[model samples]
Target: MSTEKIKAELRTEFGKGAARRIRREHKIPAVVYGHGNEPIHLTLPGHDTMMAIKHGGANALLELDIDGDAQLALTKQVQVDPVRRVLEHVDFVAVKRGEKVTVDVPVVTVGDAAPETLVVTENATVQVEAEATHIPEQFEISVEGAEAGTQFLASQIELPSGTTLLTDAETLVVNVTAAPTAEALEAELEEAEAEAGIEKDEPEAASDEAAEDGDSE
Candidate 1:
C-alpha cells in the first residue's frame, strides 16, 4: 500500500479539555508509537485525516510530515464520537518500508451464488502479514454460481504476492447452503412465535358448547 502524505503538528497539551479545543478547531489529536520510540503526541487536519482513512481502507498507511521530518506510520486505532460522528482521537504505529506488519483484511465476496442457495460468510476478515508498502486492502472471494454444500476454507483463499496468511488454514470462511423452503420458514416462524408466547389467529368467536357439538358432528 502506498503511503499518503499528511502534516502533523507537535502537540504539547494533554487533557480532555485540550482535546476538545483541538477538535473545536477542526483538528484531531493523535499519537504515534512503536519501534521502541517514545510516543509523539500531535494534531492532524481533521478533514484530510478523515479522507485519508476513508480512502485508505482498514489499515491506512501514512507518511507523516512532522516538522519537516518524515515518519512512516500505520493507522492502529481510531476513536470516534458515537453521537456526533466526529473523530475523537487516533493511534498509529511507526513503521518503515519493507517492514512486515500484521493486519486484519476484510473478506469480501464478489458475485452471486447459484439460485436458491444461501451464502454464509463465516469469517468476515482474515489476519495476514505483509510488507508495509504492499498491504492488501481486502480479500475478494468469488462465489459466482456456487452451489449448495460448497464450503470455502481460508487455505483456499488466494493471497497477494508477498503476503503471508496468519489465520489458520483449516478455518471455514464461507459456506453455501440450500435456501429454506416455504414450509420450513413457516415452521420456524411458528416456533419463534410460540416461544415468544404469541397467540396465532383463531376462528371467529364460537362458544365452547357449539365448538364441541361441531366437533362431535
Candidate 2:
C-alpha cells in the first residue's frame, strides 16, 4: 500500500475546548507516539485525512509532514461522532520503513460453495505481522466447490511474502455444512420461540384494542 501524504501542524492547546476549536477550523486533533518517544500532539486536515482513510483501509500508512519534518506513521485508532460520523480524534503510531507491525486484516471470501451447502464465517478478521508500510488491506479465501464437512483453518490461509499470521493456527476460519431444509428451519424457529417463551402476537386482537382506544379518545 502506498503511504498517504498528509500535512500536519504541531498543536500547543489541549483539552475538550481546544479539540472543539480545532474541529471548528476543519481539522482533526491527533497524537503520534511510538518507539519510546514522547507523544506529539498535532492537527491534521479533516477532509484529507478522511479521504485517505476511506480510500485506504484502517491500517493505512500515512506520511505526515509536521512543520516541514516528514515522519512515517500508521493509523492506530480513530474516534468519530456516533451520529454525525465525523472524525473527532485520531491516534497515530510512528513507524520505520521495513519494520514489522501487527495488525488485523479483514477476511474476505470469494467464489461459491457446492450446492446444498452452507458456509459460515467464524472470524471476520485475522491478526498478522507484516512490514509496516506494506500491510495488506484484506485477505481473500476461496470456497469454490467447497463440499460440506470442509473447514478452513487459520493456518491454511495463504499469507503474502514476509507476512506471518499472529492468530492461532487452529482457529476455525470458515465452516461448510449441509444446508438446512425448509422444515428444519421452521423447526428451529419454533424451538427458539419456545425456549424464549415468546409467541406470535394476534394482529386482529391488537387492532380491536387500538380501535377501542381511539373511540375513547
Candidate 3:
C-alpha cells in the first residue's frame, strides 16, 4: 500500500472538552504510540486523514509531519460518531519502515457460485502478517462454479508472497448451501407460528363453551 502523507499539529489541550474543540475545528484528535515510547497526542486534518484511510486502510502507512518532525506510523484504530458520521479519535502505532505487523485484511469475494448454490461467507476478514509499509489493500476469493456443500478453508486461500496467515489453517471461510424452497419457507412459518402460540384453526364449539360460561356468570 502507498503511504499517505499528512501534516498534524502537536496537541496542547487534553480531555473530552479539548477533543470536542478539536472536532469543532474540523480536526481529528489522535495518539501515536508503540515501540515502547510514550504516546504523543496530536490533531490531524479531518478531511485529509479520512480520505487517506478510505484509499488506504486502518493499517495503512502514514508519513506524518508533526511540529516539523517526520514520523512513520500506521493507523491502529479509528473511532467515529455514528449519528454525525464524523471521526472522533484515532490511534496510530509508530513503527519503522521495514517492520512487520499483524493486521486483519478484508476478504473480498469474486465471481458467482453455481446455479442453485448460495455461497455464504463465514469470515469477512482474515488476520495476516506483512510489512507495515506494504500491507495489502484486500484479498479476493473466487467462488466460481462452486457446488452446494462446497467449503473454502483458510488454508485453501492463496496468499500473496511474503504474507503469512495468522489465523488457523483449518478454519472454514466460506460455506456453499442450497437455497431454501417454497415448501421449506411454509414449514418454517408454521413452526414459528406454533412456537409463538398461534393456533392455525380453533373449533367453533370451544368458542361457544366460553360464551355460555360468560352468560351464566
Candidate 4:
C-alpha cells in the first residue's frame, strides 16, 4: 500500500476538445473532490498515472503535488477508451491518512480443489472498509484439498489488520461440486438444446427440392 507521487497541474480548460488536447500531450484530465471541498480540475502525467494504477491496483493511493501543495487522494473512478484501451479520465477523492473508506476488494483464489471437482466463484469482489492509505489490494482464499460439496462464505474470509468486511456474512464466495463426466455433459447439452427448441437443419432435402424447382423453371 505505497502512495505514488504524481505531479499535477491545475487545468482551466473544460469540454471534450480540451480533454482531447490534454491527452494528445501525454497527459490525462482528472478531477479531485471530497471533504466538502470544491472540485479541482487538473492534468496528470498519463504514463506515470497508468503505471501506478497497474502496479497498485484500483485502490491506489496517490500523493498529488499541485503547485507545491501536496494532497493525499484515493483513485475512485477511471474512464477508459474501450477500443483504444487508453485512459480517458480519472476521478480522485481526497482522504486523510487515518480515514476509513469503503471499497470493493477483488477476490482471488489460491491452490486447487479435490480432483474431479469444479470450483465455482459466486462473488468476484467483496466490499470492505479499511484505512484509505492501507487498503488491501485483494483477498486470497485457499481451496487446497477442498472436497466436493464444500462451500465458502464471506464471513469465513480472513481480513487484514484494520480491515473490516462490509459484505454480507452469509454471501457465498466459492463452491466446490463434483464435475460432470463427458457423457453427462453431452446429455446436458442435448437437453438444453431440446428445451430451447433448437433442431438440426434439414438443408440437404431443402437444397434438392430447390434444384428440382429450378430445373422445372
- The candidate scoring highest on TM-score is 1
Q: Give every collision pair in model 2.
A: none
Global lDDT of model 2: 0.94
**Tens-digit lDDT track for model 4 on 1-217?**
9999999999999999999999999899999999999999999999999998778797888999999999998999999989988889999999999999999999988999999999999999999999998899989999999999999999999998999999999999999999999999999998999999999676998989989999999
Q: Over the stretch 101-166, how does candidate 3's per-residue lDDT look in tens digits?
A: 999988777899999887888998889999888788888888999889998888887888788999
**lDDT per model, in order?**
0.93, 0.94, 0.89, 0.94
Cα-based TM-score, every candidate: 0.91, 0.87, 0.88, 0.89
Cα deviation in Å at residue 55, candidate 4? 1.0
Name model 2 segments beyond 4 Å from true.
200-217
Q: Which stretches of candidate 3 lie over 4 Å from their true place?
A: 196-217
Task: List, in order, the clash count of every candidate structure.
Answer: 2, 0, 0, 0
The residue-by-residue lDDT of candidate 2 on 1-217, one tens digit each, is 8889999999999999999999999999999999999999999999999988877787988999998999999998999999999999999999999999999998888999999999999998999999998899988899999999999999989998999999999999999999999999999999999899998776998989999999999
Global Cα RMSD, each model = 2.6, 6.1, 3.7, 4.4
Q: How accurate is candidate 3 locally (lDDT)?
A: 0.89
Give every collision pair in model 3. none
